[model samples]
Target: MLKSQRLIRMIMIINARKSFTVQEMADEFGLSTRTVTRDLLELSELGVPIYSIQGRGGGYRLLQERLLPPIAFTESEAVAMFIACRSLRHLSALPFDEGAESALHKFYHYLPEDSKTRIDRLKDKVAIWSPHRQVLPDCLRTLMQSIMVRSVVAIEYRSTHGVELRNIQPVGLYESDGYWYCPAYCFLREDYRVFRADRILAASLNESIDCREDVEQRTLWDLPQERAPLIPMSLELSPGGVHALRSDQWFGESIRVRDDGGGTVTVDIPSDKIPFYSDMIWRLGEDARIVAPEEAVEYVRRKIEAMRLRYS
Candidate 1:
C-alpha cells in the first residue's frame, strides 16, 4: 500500500470506530464512495471488527476480541480512551500519560505510515476524565493490590460510630464517583458485605489467606440480591438521593427504581439488608419517605425517632 493508503487504513482503524460514516471517510479521503467502502471491507478482511449502523444515535463501532487484540486507534479514539482512563487517576495517583503512550505504541505498531504528530496533538487536545485531589491511604492501596492479584485482603474497619473492629476477607475493590470500596465476606458479621475504603482503619495482604481465586468474585454482589428473606418493600426517593443509590460493585443489581416526584421514588428492598437503603435515607434526610413493607417503614420511623431524640 502507498503511504496515503496506509494512512487511510490507520484513520479507519482509529477514528472511524464510532460515529464515523463511510461517506464521511470518502469525502475526507477525496475518494469515491465505493473506494471508502472497499477500504472498510479490507479492514474487516484483515481481522478488524468495524461495523456500521444507520439511525438516530447510531454509528460505527469496532468490536475487540482475542483474535484482534491489538490495533491502532485514530487520533480521536486515542484521545477518547485517554480521557476515559484519566478519570480513574484518583484510584491511584500515578503518571497515566506515560502508561497510555506505551499502550498506544503497541496499538499503532503496525501502522508505519500513520501521522504520529497528529495523534500526539489530538491527545494533547483531548480531555474527559477529571482528576480529584483526594488522598488514598497506603494501606487501602495495598489491599487493592491484593485484590488485583486475586489475593485475600484482611481488614480492621471502624464502624459507623467509629468504634469497632470488623475483620473481613476482601473479594474485590471497586470505585463509585470519587470513593473506593472493598466488597468482601465479613467473618465477624458471618455474612458477605461491603466496606468503604475511607472507613478501613487497617488493611493488609495475608499470605496465609486461603480462598478460591477461581470463583468469580461477582458472587459476593449476587449474595445481596439472593438473601433468603426478601424485604419485598418499597419507598419514595428524593431526586438528589437517586444518583447515590445506584448499585456499587458490592451492592448487587437494583430490582427497580421509579421516580415518584421531585422529592420521591419507589423501591423494594430487604429489611435485614436495609443498610444501603437506610444509609441513603440518612444521606437524603427529609427528602425521602418509606411507603411499603411495613417493616421497612417502621425501621425508617424508628431511625427518624432516634434522630429526633438525639437532637432533643
Candidate 2:
C-alpha cells in the first residue's frame, strides 16, 4: 500500500518527469504490472501529469516546459489545452488574448494528421466554462510567456475583496480548474501567495525578481490553507454534502469526498465560515457530523445560533 502510494506521489508531483513502463516500474518496485497500471490511471483522474504515448517509437513522457520546444498536440491534447485555456482566460492572466491568432496560426501549422482529425471532432462538440470575467487579455499573455520562459514578473493586483493592492513576484503560471493563477512571492507580505490572473490591474516582466529559495511544493490538486487564521477540523458529510464536494463550485477543496457512493466527505476549515461549512453539514443535518478536533462542534453551535437568529 505504501509503495503504491509512493509511486502515485512520484508520478503526480513531477509534472515534467517521464514515467517508467508498467513492466519496468513493477519490476523495479517489486509489484505486479496490473497494480502499477492501476496506480497510473488513478493518478490521471487527479489531473496528474501522466499521459500515454503510442507507436513503436512511443512509451511515456511527462511534459516539462524547458525540455520540449513548441510541441505538437494531438487533437485530444489540443482541445484539452484549449478548454483549460478558455477557463483560465476568466480567472488568471492570459498572455494571449483572442488575438492568439498568431499562436493559433502557429499551433495549427504543427498539427499531426491524427491531431487535425481530433480538432475537427472537438469543433463539433463545443464546451463552455464560467469564471470571473474581469481578467484582462494581456494579463493572460504575460502568464503564458512567463510559463514558457520561466521568467519572473511584477504585478500590481487587487484582492478578491477588492480592498488590497499588492506587488508580487510570480514564480509560476498555473491553470487550475479553468482559472488562471500564479503562485508567487509577495514582496509586501514576504510570503508565497496565489494570485488570480483576472485580478491583476497591470503587469510587466521584471528581470529583477527571481525564483525564491523559500518556495514550497504545493498541490494545485489541493488548495493551500488561507493566510488568515482558521479553525481546522474534520467532519463527516452526507450524500448531498458529498455531491457538493464534486466541484469547488459551492464548497471548496477542504470539503473532500470519500468513497464512491457520495456518502462521506471530510472537511477542514475556519470558524469564520462556520455557517458556510457547518451549516452545509447541518442542512445535511443527520447526514453530517463533526468527527475530529473538538473545536468544530462549537463552530457548528455558532452556525446554529446564526441560523436561529436569521430565521427569528
Candidate 3:
C-alpha cells in the first residue's frame, strides 16, 4: 500500500484500541520496527496525541479526549498545495478574501516540521514570472455566479470592433498570458465565444434561460489549449537557442534533449503561434532553424521578405 494510505490505516488501528505495540503494528502492516517507529514520530509531529508507556506490555496510546480526524498527505501533494496557495494568495479578486489565508494557516500548522522548513526554502527558489495583474476583474465574480447557476447574463463587452451588449451563458473561466478569459455561449452570435474578462464593461443577470444543455459537463478542453490542427514540427537550435529552450521553465517540459550536453532539442510549435516562433527565431539570428513542416519554412521566408521590404 502507499505510505499515505498506510498512515491512515495505522491511525484507524490506533484509534480503535486503547494502545498498540511497535511489534504489533509492524506485523500488521508488513513494515519493519524502525519504519513503524518513524511513522509514529511523523504522526506525533503532525499533532496527533500519541504518547508512550514503558512496561512488559507497554506500547503507545492516545492522550484522553485528544483524538483528531485521521489525516495523511504525501510530500508531493503537500508541496503542490503550498505552491497553488502561494500563487493565489496574492489575488484580491477571488471570493472570500480571507479564505486562502485561513487555509494556508491551517495547512502550514498541520505540516510536519521538516516539510514546513523545506517549503520555506522553496519560497526562495521557485518563482512564477508573469505580468502584473489586478486583484479581480470588474465582473469576474458576477460572471462566476452566473456560471454556477447556469443562468444567462447580459454583458456590455468592449470588443476590438466596438462596444456591444451580449447575452451569454458562461461555461468556464481561465487565465492565460496574464489575462482572464470566459468561454460562453453567445446568444447574438449563436455560437460559443471567448470573452476577455477585462474587456467586460458591465454585466447583469438576465431572465433568459440558459439553453446550453451540457454547460455543467463542459471542460477547459472545450476551448483550445493549443493551436488548432496541430502540425508536426522539427527544429535545429544553436547552443544559445538550446539554452533559451532549457531555461524557460514551461517550455522545458515539452523539449526532448538531443544530447547530454544540451546542444540541441526537438519540439513541436503550435501552427497558430508560428508568427511568434518566427519572431523568436529572428532574435536568435541564425541560431535557430525550422527543419520540417514546409509550411513553416515558407511562412518564415515570407516574414523575412516582408521585414526586408519594410526596412528597404
Candidate 4:
C-alpha cells in the first residue's frame, strides 16, 4: 500500500485498538518493527496522542482524547456540514458548546477560499432562527450522560409548583423552540415526566437509586404513546393564522388549508395539553377561534375575563 494509505489505515487501527504494541501493528501491516516504530513517531508528531508504556503489559496506547482518522468530503458535503453547524449558533446552550465552536472554527479555517467566501455570503442570507432564550441549562451535559449510561440522577429542579429534589432515570434529551427538555422516569412521580433543562438547578448521579432498565429503552419518539388520552379538537384559522400555524412544528401537520386561504387545524390532543393549546390559540387573537372542545374554549374565556378584571 502507498505510505499515505498505510498511514490512514494505521490511524483507524490505533483508534480501534486504543492500546497495541508496535509489533502488533507491524505484523498486521506486514512491515518491519523499525518501520512501524518510525511511523508511530510520525503519527505522534501529527497530533495522534500516542504514548509509550515502559512497564510490562503496557504497550503503546492512545491518550484518552485520541485523534480520529481523517475522512474525505466533497466540497458540497463540506458546505452542507458548515451550514448545519452554523444553524446551531442561535441556541443559548449546547451539550458540547465548546467542542462545537472549536470544530466549526477548525472546519471553516480549512475550507477553500471560494467556499469560505460562499459561506461568508450565506452567513448573512440563511439562518435557522430560534427564539433567544436567556436561561442556560447547566445540567444539559449531566442529563445527556445519564441517558447514555442509563443512570439515575438526583436533580434540584424548579417547576411551576416550586423547587424540589427528585431522582430520575433519563430517557433522552431533546431541543425544541430553543429550550432543552429531558424526558425521564421521575422517582417522585413514579412515572415519566418531561423536565425543562433550564429549570434543573443541579444534577448529580444518584448512587442509591437503581436505574430503571425499561426507562433506558424509552426514546423521545415514544413520548406520544405515553401521553394522556387524546381528545378530538378543532380550530378555525384566518389566513394570517394559517400562515403562522404553518410554521409551528407541533401544530403545522394538523392544519388543513381551505380554498379561501384560511385553514382548520384538526388534532387529537392529549387532555393535559388543553390549557397549552388554549393559551396559544388565545394569543392569535381574532385570527384563531376554537371550533370544538368546550374545555379549551372555556379556558380562553376565563383567561380573557381574568385579564379584563385586572385592567378594570
For lDDT, the strongest prediction is: 4
What shift in Å separates residue 119 of candidate 4 from its native position after superposition? Answer: 2.1
| Candidate 3 ranges beyond 4 A from true positions | 1-76, 90-98, 112-115, 223-312
lDDT of 2 by residue, 104-208 (tens): 555666677677676667653565554445567687677567555655667767764664655555556665455677777677788777787767887777667
Which of candidates 1 and 3 is the stronger one according to TM-score?
3
| CA lDDT scores, all candidates in order | 0.58, 0.61, 0.74, 0.84
Off by over 4 Å in 1: 1-71, 89-135, 160-168, 187-190, 213-228, 237-265, 285-287, 293-312
Task: Name the better of 3 and 4 by TM-score.
Answer: 4
Query: Highest TM-score: which candidate?
Result: 4
Which sequence of candidate numbers ranks them by TM-score, best first? 4, 3, 1, 2
Instruction: Encode model 3's per-residue lDDT on 1-312: one tens digit a residue.
Output: 998888888877888876889999999998999999999999899767889989889999888634545557798888988888777644535533355666778888878899999999888467564445663444887788787667888999988689999999888887754567788878998777888887888887886665567655677676535534666666677666777666654345555656643444446676776665666556666766877677778888898899999999
Please say which candidate is ahead in TM-score: 2 or 4: 4
Q: Count clashing residue pairs per candidate.
A: 4, 14, 1, 0
- Candidate 3: TM-score? 0.51
TM-score of each model, in listed order: 0.51, 0.47, 0.51, 0.88
